[model samples]
Target: MSDQAQSTTMTPPAPSDFDGRRAFGRAARIRTPRTSHAVWSPPADRADPVSLLEEQATSRVPDLVPVRHGRMMVSPFTFYRGAALLMAADLATTPNSGLTVQLCGDAHLSNFGLFGSAERHLVFDINDFDETHPGPFEWDVKRLVASFEIAGRHRGFDDKDRRAIILAAGRAYRERMLAAAESTVLDAWYDHLDVDTMQAWLHDERQAERAAKRQVKTFDAVVAKALTKDSMQAFAKLVTTDGGQMRIIGDPPLIVPVEDLLDDTDIDDPEKAAREILASYRNTLFASARHPLSEYTYVHMARKVVGVGSVGTRAWIVLMRGRDELDPLFLQAKEAQASVLERFLEPCEYDNQGERVVRGQRLMQASSDIFLGWQRVRGEGRIERDFYVRQLHDWKGSLDAEKAVPRGTLLYAWICGETLARAHGRSGDRVEIAAYLGKSDAFEESIAAFAEAYADQNEADYQAFTAAVADGRLRAVHGL
Candidate 1:
């Protein structure tokens, strides 16, 4: 076996098994005593973000090479940016006064976005979950706050403004957690941020943030335009007739064709194994009448390169045709594996990692992809991985934090806080957590300190990544 294959076969340490309530108790233990404790100090002579990023990349689970390459090439900053999973693990070890929740494992700013709901309304919430599992609620809050601090710095925000944003986020989280704890479980489950509702909330605050509201409205438009069927024509334009057959441009490691990943498949073979894999996907589709996807007919499938961190992973875009050419459905099948969060979470009863993600997402998010499900496929040596299917793109969008004003940052922080609180409300110790956060700004300041320190670590990792590339220790396929 190749070195990579050998590593994949060796199981990593299984996560600790703490029930949600007990987990919160452990976290609370750390936070309660620390209520008067000074902020956790960062390592002296901290590594540059670039170097820290490189070290984190080396630790990625083996089955995700495709995504890893794309993540690496996004820029030293972006690579450092994508290393939140590494940061989360490190932060979990810090001295805590036991504040915890069910966290969105990857809670960086960019992870929040808009997606269509069952009602077809565009709703905004957390979007990625490759690293999601149960852990301290504070972990998610800290990560979100820290990301804001780092991103604010990247956007040239002054330290004062960055601190304000972090504080606002913490306050929002604390308040929202308390509010949700008082709300009915079903009510919280049904809650979501539609555009109009978001606008109303902003306007009601009378917070002098008109520009921020306008920006979110503009973002909604951009996402709608980008995800439309006509927009896919832009994708089709990238295809060319090669020997009279339409094919996507082959940009190695990024836009790899599905044929490249499969062996012994000739251009003339109509029923190649990869094609069979696509055929198998149809069986996994949600039942007709229940899922809008029933109307779609399998048209074609291609390996799509996606996300800075996921660029090198096996990601496929499955296109389905409806009644007419204008009607189309796209489903993304990104390979899933044990999350870095799994290193901290207890082992689950389900065998498939994709099932773990789907279950976790459903548990944490107010709503989830209607088609969210998992399946096992025959990979090298019958390796079992996971796959969560979702609409490829339906009015999906996010804020451009680099250009966002202070008001926008504050508003985004509020939304994130509220969302995190809702998730935490589902846990066992909401009463104690709500009490600990206690309408005070101290926790916010502590989180800001943590973010600043961690962001430094991210930069260090990024630098190390570039150095590794320069020294020929790692390979990168750039400019895809």
Candidate 2:
């Protein structure tokens, strides 16, 4: 096996006794009853959520920190997306099944999306790994289900509809885990949710309910749009030509070219420094006689602000030209910090934070970007930081929760639940997790209740956040 494969692989030993595994799971209920999952009252000594955000901001780029606050302030759902740290603390107070999984630690609804598989087929899976770490499996489920609840409230969905949507996700997760438990080890490992399968699932839902065909049309439209969102599309949208030299367009705080940032800096030769960093990153990729990345030569780079939670820490878009300018590759080198879950659980195994993300992603994701790699670079103040690199856009697409109708959102929630189960089953004991969940809806109903309670907590936290910004405790530039 390759070194990368060896380092990241965490396959459990072949189960000698399925009944024993299931018994262990069932026994866990005595220690932590299934109904206990519904509880979500904050501890008396709970840390202030706003204070945690302030502490986190100290390590990020100062100027971009407010942008993160601004993005989070958009709505309670948005605030929930950026408050993984706050939620991680709260989840620590809850009861767990003790069935561990390689979690997509920030598995909010927005984090589950569509991306191109290595085979070029578009597949839906967890797309973010900023805080990925092994912990209680239900932690991911609660975060995902609660996102639907919070989002449903944001869209003015009735309480009944919101409860149904949340229940769909919880039920789907339980069913999928049970199914994985019955399957062979290899079968569970090979499972993936491709676009064709996704379309079929949606079609079946529509056929059973005799719902509008527009859902199918929406699925097709999303798939079509995703296929067009490859690197070529990114190049077309982000690159500009100046004096016959292609360069990343400068859009200030959002996208600043390297030259602009290096103007008065101590870095003597900016391009040379950039190339050296690129060369170090290249070594981290799958190295053969000639790696695929070696085909591309470094051209230009820019610092870019990206995503809701990932706004502050340094992120850069590196431009590479393969064959010529027409054939370009855009790689995003995003900083990787200690996971939000780290404080609550055990520390990460990988010393390099970037490797922690890449490895966790490989363990949970059925398919990953080919260009995925990690490197540590010393920048500006000569301080070294870890960053994981991947293609800026590889047929990426996402559902806009704000615009999705109730039926569509419910269907998407089911898919997200199934996707999360497949991910968990890969790394955790499928038989154990499945047995813990059982054939009953006890766990599912409990989680749905927890989602509702957490949504209420999120609204309270959002209020405190906005208050901080209003009183000048936190700076926020709106409408970015």
Identify the candidate with maximal TM-score.
2
| Local accuracy of candidate 2 as per-residue lDDT tens digits, 327-349 | 99999989999999887777799
Cα lDDT, model 2, residue 56: 93
When summed lDDT is taken over every stretch of 10 residues in candidate 2, the lowest stretch is 1-10
Tell me the tens digit of each residue's lDDT in model 1 across 152-189: 77777887888788877887887876665455656655
RMSD of 2: 4.6
Clashes of 1: 47
Cα lDDT, model 2, residue 315: 91
Global fold similarity of model 1 (TM-score): 0.79
TM-score of each: 0.79, 0.95
What total of clashing residue pairs does each candidate reach? 47, 0
